[model samples]
Target: MDVADLAALETGGSLWTWHRGLRDGTAVVFDLDGVLSDAASRQHHLKGPRPDWEAFFAASGDDPLINEVATVLHLLAPELIVVLLTARPARVRTATLGWLDRHQLRWDLLVMRKDGDRRPARHFKQEAVRGVRERGMDVALCFEDDLRNVEMFRSEGIPTLYVHSGYYD
Candidate 1:
């Protein structure tokens, strides 16, 4: 892979390396909340969980797609099996789908936190990515903004591209 090409991808605050690995046709996993949608820092505080998720999910308030994120998504749309792996509870599936529809964001798979799985966010995400791999999909890269999750993924041998959070002030 060309160093310059990799550096160019980082220009959008994303270390995108999927295109280089696409020769073998691999899937790409993306964290939806902070990377694609400005949900974490803008919609609610990161330190506390939202008191009412059903209500929060039902509302269209947390629907803004981060700039430049869509460009990468569109670029990857044609050849990649875009998997939107999120830590969102399964109970919010309906509302989440609504939000995705409103934003016109489509995914080949939408992995969510399973009921009764109270694992930390980092572990939960690692499992989500692993679930995809278990199904025989070669995950070329993961786009995420959480450093903790990035470390977890890297620990498991999955390469991660640090997605600069739009949530930061």
Candidate 2:
């Protein structure tokens, strides 16, 4: 089907537009960290220096899926506005942006948590998704690897495609 037809499929709907342009004017939101890279797994394996956290960001060098996913996004929906919603600190904003650029990924928005909030990460992510949805662009889908975040997105009526990380495999 065409982009317009896909966009009108449902209110806050998600359809596989991997080979189709975005419906007339809809945005696609993606979760960074776990979904794009094996951040969570790296973090889990590297306990020496906060394994999970370090591995999440440090494993950027050898990540295999970054280019693959980027290529898919580039080919499937080049016109769709892409956003990266993450709980990473705002301090890493420059680094994150650099990573995306280096990987040749296209994204429209990068939402990060503020400096001093201790709330649960999932809550912060939910708020970010809500903010994106309120901006007049329907959130077509969210690519995520965290179950809690997935649940949060679903609770907010956002459809999620869970990346099958090696943790479960």
Candidate 3:
């Protein structure tokens, strides 16, 4: 299916809430940066006159493994509610949402960190997970690539999938 198909399925309005399972009810929380997209590299800007941000991102998107994982999540975890918790500021929400739209990746909720926060990114993510839990849903798993974030989620008793990267492992 394409992005349009996924968007139509989302249908907005409390999509973040858990859907009752055939046997057991559970929720699936996702990290925005490394889990859903190649957002890790976007944190840094390409330097020099020949810098090609689009090309750089396109190169990363060529990975077959990442696409495979995304497809698996879309199929196997269709019933599980998905949330994209990111430290990205609200200013980039449009671009981020556009990226999600283009990729056809459907998420129930998108939580972006607000500015004027003194806490670390990991702490912010941990708090977001807590908020999700407070909404009366069981977070079955949280997918993140940064080791710091993985540790933060683990400390909160949340299971996490650490996406391995060369620099951050």
TM-score of each: 0.72, 0.70, 0.69
Two-way TM-score contest, 1 vs 2, winner: 1
- After superposition, the stretches of candidate 3 with alpha carbons farther than 4 Å from their true spots are 1-25, 40-65, 167-169
The whole-model C-alpha lDDT of candidate 2 against the native structure comes to: 0.61
Q: Write the per-residue lDDT of candidate 1 for residues 1-169, one digit (tens) a residue.
A: 2333211121111122222232334788888777888775335533365455544444534668776876788777576788777777666665666676677764666667764566787877766666567657889888888888889888878788988874434
Worst 10 residues of 1 by lDDT: 6-15
Per-residue lDDT tens digits for candidate 3, residues 122-141, read: 87777677767776668888
Query: In terms of TM-score, which candidate is strongest?
Result: 1
The model with the greater lDDT, 1 or 2, is 1
Error of 1 at 122 (Å): 1.3
Clashes of each: 0, 4, 0
Where does candidate 2 stray beyond 4 Å? 1-24, 44-65, 166-169
Query: How would the candidate models be sorted by lDDT, starting from the highest?
Result: 1, 2, 3
